[model samples]
Target: MSLVVSSINLKIYFMKTFLAITALVSFQLAAGQKTIELKDFNSLSVGSDTKITMVKSSQNKLVINSSDDDDLSIVNEGGFLKLNGGEDLEITLYYKDGLESISADADAEVWGKDEIKAKELSITASADAKIELVLNVKKLNTTISSDAMVTLTGKAENHNAVVSSDADFKGEDLLTENTNILLSSDGTAAISVKGIVDANVSNDALLKVYGNPKKVNEITSTDGHIKIVR
Candidate 1:
């Protein structure tokens, strides 16, 4: 009786182990890649950047090709195209549709092509997320709430930026008049720009402007530093 009982216990253990393995395989198969598309949207909002890029296409279609299809989502809400991606992957983008505006939020890393053209652009970054965009636009606005980073290149009519925590901003060729550029840093922010700059800075932040200031404000930095180079 003892031998029989031992044999039965051993068999039960093997059966349970086999069942667990089978369940794991089924789950892996179910989590395969998925594909999705949208026909019409005026703007874009992405939660995070998983190695995404925009390319000019011949057709008027917005395509998102993901490395892991199951980890990407695209939605159209209120005439806006919203995108979200998984933690450590990338999604490629192809678009010719006339998108008017674009925004990145919720701790996302967004990278654009070298010559992305738009009417308006905005970025609200926090939680260590970063955005590197090279765009030709009319207006650009950026807000950094936490320890995030943003870098912008290309030409623009107006550039407005605010950094409140340990955030940073780097602007290249961000051409605008003295009256149209506003850059403010409330904390230990690091800001760099290569255009005519007029700014008000505070705290232990650093602002570097590589152009002239025609109408200067009382640019105050309580415990900060502001540097300008022609």
Candidate 2:
């Protein structure tokens, strides 16, 4: 009976020590992976010039982290999160709490080195924002109000664009079911669509469509060109 009691005590002691070490390691990891919460927000919106990347993870929280986290400001405004930063910032956005959509209205540059998976995305690129997105989403909608340069690639179900200035929009390998464009003024679009295209372009704005377009309508441009490929 004494030997049995000694064995049980030894086992309990080892279990306690193991738990202590495990807790220590967990604390260290949590400290290393410092993240800022996007609290009280269901969607993400950026109003300043910033660079953003989406991280694909199973965690359900919208958290952002950067190497230099001091100059960044993330605010929640009426159930939406807005991002603002200074200098060249590499921002990683993780949608851990079921973030559904993204909207950006600033003159920011978006690099395609990271991939974003979402249900919907809308970008209003004014003031000549150099925008590029490599995404896997259901719908992609964009509006260009200035001479912004935009590029979009990846797999999506639907794509819609509206250009109102002397901007250039390009898409490569953007396999989608439906593509729609409404261009005004000196806007130009060169895109590759896998399905159908419907465009109403006017006033020296050009539209180019490549892929099997089942239906096309009103693709007109005065002093501009409309090119289509099967």
- C-alpha RMSD (angstroms) for model 1: 10.0
RMSD of each: 10.0, 7.6
Question: What are the models' TM-scores?
Answer: 0.69, 0.70
lDDT against true structure, model 2 = 0.71
In the range 111-178, model 2's lDDT, one tens digit per residue, is 54457777887766777677676777788887877788777778778989898788888875667778
lDDT of 1 by residue, 1-230 (tens): 99999999999999999999999987775564334455666676667544456656644334333236566667877777777774565454556646666566666676766576777766667766777777777777777756777777667666677776777777644555432333444443333344445566777676666546554453765666666656
Off by over 4 Å in 2: 1-34, 60-71, 97-99, 112-115
Candidate 1 yields a Cα-based lDDT of 0.62
Query: What are the clashing pairs of model 1?
Result: 50-90
Off by over 4 Å in 1: 1-35, 58-68, 179-196
Best by lDDT: 2
